[model samples]
Target: MPSEIAPAGLRERKKEETRRLLLEGAAHLFKERGFEGTTVADIAAYANVSVRTFFRYFESKEALLLPDGVEIFAYVEHALSERPADEAPLDAVCNALLAAAKPFSASTLTALSHPLEDIENVITARLVQAFSDFEERLTVLVQRRLPPDTPDADLKAAVIACAALSAVRAVLRTRRARRASGISDTGPAPLLRAFGILHEIGSPERP
Candidate 1:
């Protein structure tokens, strides 16, 4: 029994270690050779794992790039659950967006550091797949906040996703602009502004 338990424990630890190595390896290769130039074989080699093992962890390259979408959905769900039942869905979403911005912002910057032009073709392909997964996760979260008899729930969810994604992208763009312009603000003002704009646009009064 002890031997059995030991192997299970060791296997779990090894799985986690393998995942960490894969992510680190991908980041390095993405920066060095660009996302498009790197292959699953390259990632597997960098992680010192078999190509078969890579598939076990990630179905495709896009999965490696945006691994935290599920985790972010969980965070959004938790945030929404904590709000009072009477709170407006839009407000709850806005609050959730604010809560989520920190981690997502950090990850976006890290992902962008990977050479883009060279990797654009491959990254775009992966992103199309990844964004589909992301939309599904987001729809589930939005549906939970809407009324049971809500008309056009799917449409509303799509709009919400669009709004939220736009806000995040706009924030990143503003940050980049400021950095390029040599603005000295180190604060998260750009993200806060993005959230505020999204909140206003998503509010019921906007219609």
Candidate 2:
């Protein structure tokens, strides 16, 4: 049994190492040739794997470049659920978004350091699509937090989730713009500011 388990574990590790090599190779080629310019063959050759092996791991070059949205979404959902029960609705969502953002930024999306302009555009478009997915899932999670008997509960959840997700998109867009302009600022400050604005919108009194 131990011998059988050892071989399986080694095989899994080798598969994971191959996947990582492909991602790292893709990142390097993307930086050198831009997203549109890079090809699957180029990545496979760089990783010293056959093109067929690359396909066994990733469906396309874009798949190699994009972060795993399902994994990130799960992370956000778990983080939101684990927040203190007494925490404010907005604050809970904010914390979850921030927690997810750190790993998101550290993923393949930013591994290129500074992706070319075209590559950045592709990433920005993909993220915008992901925002919609996050909003849909978050609405359900936010709804769970509200009293079941609350009036317009579904609408309230949808609005809150949408607003919170827009903040995530806002932060990404702002950072991308700043990076394009050669102004480097990578932190949670932008996200915090976006949520602060949301808080003011729901304030009881307007100045």
Best by lDDT: 2
Candidate 1 residue-wise lDDT at 142: 73
* Local accuracy of candidate 2 as per-residue lDDT tens digits, 109-192: 343323333454786566556667778889999988887797999999998889887776666667777877998767666777
- Give TM per candidate: 0.64, 0.72
lDDT (C-alpha) at residue 135 in model 1: 61
Q: What lDDT is reached at residue 10 by model 1?
A: 96
What's the lDDT for all of these models?
Answer: 0.69, 0.76
Question: So what's the TM-score on candidate 2?
Answer: 0.72
Q: Can you write out model 1's per-residue Cα lDDT over 9-84, one digit (the tens) per residue? A: 9999999899989988987888798866889999999999999999999998778776665566577667767877
Cα TM-score of candidate 1: 0.64
